[model samples]
Target: MATGESRARSIGQQATGRTVLKTHPGSKTAVLVALAALVTGCGGSASDTAPTKPSAGHRAGSGSGSDGSSAGTVGFDTVFKTEERFQQALPDPASMAGWTPRNASALIEDDPEPAARCAPSRDWECAKIAHGEANFEAFGEEADFDITAFVDKAGAGEACRKEATWSAKYTKAPGAAVSDVESHAYYRNVGGENGLYVTMCLGTVVAEVTLAGPNSSLDPDTAHSLARQFVPRIQKAAAAS
Candidate 1:
């Protein structure tokens, strides 16, 4: 595990915020409501009723269901027992119609630290969802590093700067065994690119999601909505192991 300052710097560079737009009840059409309620990371619900294939804007999930048909796989599925299932969590451009992959490898899935990265002993399983526009990743491993500290330090402003030219954007909610499992979100923009990052520490897993847009100013309401949608999915991924 990385030590105090080292850990802070490592996670600080890695983890980070929320402002969002709200949907008005005055909206008439479902399409209008969905358009109003934006999300950076796209996927279906965790329930059994959720779609097996990736949703409209999402580009994750793989393989066929029990009925010999391709199922839309998005988010954390309890059926992920093998490495194939884990690998299937990765996004494929050709898998979806009218989908174009510009820069898929821009978001990395490996540990940030150079020396103390995930080794064989650490036994880490990482799944990343990245596109030219956004980045999303999930990490599952033995209790090797202190992820709780990462979350706490991140929120305390000891890790990464809450106000990275954007603002102090965070999302938290009650009702969880682990206090930090609630959620933490922040945003930053470098050059003409704007990115929104949200991190969650659950069990021995740390799930991170991000949105990178070409514009300098991103929609806070969209980031908030994405964070809210993704936090539970991260929790489910952590519990799958």
Candidate 2:
């Protein structure tokens, strides 16, 4: 009886060991799949949290800045138009008094075109005189004169002279020397606002005249009528320049 029992126990133990060996490979594969799932879950969550970049079109409107506040549209055309209108308001040389007739050869001399008939001295020249509508440009020379300072000297007076304003001097060519010759004067009919008289030193002469209507008290209707007639001609002359 004891021998039979021992043999049965040995058979049971051997069967149990064989079953464990057969299932070992499948258990390892299951554990590996679970580990792979855990790693995939962590990776997918990180990807979802990443920040997105803006589209190219959106970035362009934001200008060239990290904070998106530096870009805008510029109105270059409007600025240019304003400048053109100001230029058009300037006076013309042919309409001024003391100016000679249009003569290309006369300009070759050291004398200014209007001064051709007058004596030529250092900074001393003559200007032609013309009146109508009161928009004209007179040409002459000045010696040792500060035009800007002169205009400032005039201050807000109705008729005074000290220095010339930028509006008066900007039209001339560079290196065109001015002299002080009190022999010349700048006159503007002003069309009733009141007239203006600008007198400079002897070597200084009147170069241009831009009338804004007579003095302030003049008739507005008459001034407007004159402006309408004169502004067109002045504009045409400036355009030729």
Candidate 3:
């Protein structure tokens, strides 16, 4: 939801190779939008450019028994049936030990302009139809993880894949293998603190999770372990829908 001069300034700073300041705790959507703009806008510099093609990070079925879960594809009508159902499918920090969570309002990109802003592109390859996100902070440390589930039109997983790939490249993070789904992982260093970002696509849902903090012991293994639990819930929700 960050627009006007502030949004422009965010993108400009990223383009010019400046350290992107950590946004406030409440602006998760704005942070995601700024990240999308960073990948699309910073195509000139070698370090800023993303791969034109997706990496073979991990290949598996769309929650169809690969990860020992039977969640499969559902129609758009089912997945987008209601906003509450979508929100209910998101990751719950209560399930994770010692983590406190706050959720943002679910976003539905029903209009063209907002959809365009979701993933800036002439062809709109990375736009999402709807998304729900939450931020979770550790009980007594400067560490946290943010998880978001994005739903796209039926059979449009490729768009979600593009967004994940661009994000990984922008951070110069390496790909990691996640079981039972198509996924990518990247290592991130924000303000000299280490973090991990992992994304997986299941059916029409793209689940993104980021873990960061200097004091936190979270790593790729922890993130992937959480995805193994959280991704299946999303898949089950879609199948039920």
Q: Could you give candidate 2's per-residue lDDT for residues 60-169 as a string of tens digits?
A: 11111121121111111111111222222222222222221111100111111232343332222222111111121112211110111111111212111323442244
What are the Cα lDDT values of the candidates? 0.28, 0.21, 0.45
Error of 1 at 58 (Å): 12
Write one digit per residue (lDDT tens) for candidate 1, span 1-241. Answer: 3211110111111112222233324322111011100111233211212123445554231111122222322222232222222223322222221222222212222223332342433222211111112222211100011122122222222222222222333333222222334345565555755565555443323344455544313334434444444444334333444
Most TM-score-accurate candidate: 3
Listed per candidate, the RMSD to the true structure in angstroms reads 18.3, 43.1, 14.5
TM per candidate: 0.32, 0.16, 0.55
Kindly provide the TM-score of model 2 when superposed on the true structure, using C-alpha atoms.
0.16
Predicted structure 1, TM vs. truth: 0.32
* Candidate 1 overall lDDT versus native: 0.28
Deviating ranges (above 4 Å) for candidate 3: 1-70, 73-78, 112-126, 139-155, 168-176, 190-193
Off by over 4 Å in 1: 1-180
Better of 1 and 3 by TM-score: 3
Error of 3 at 142 (Å): 7.2
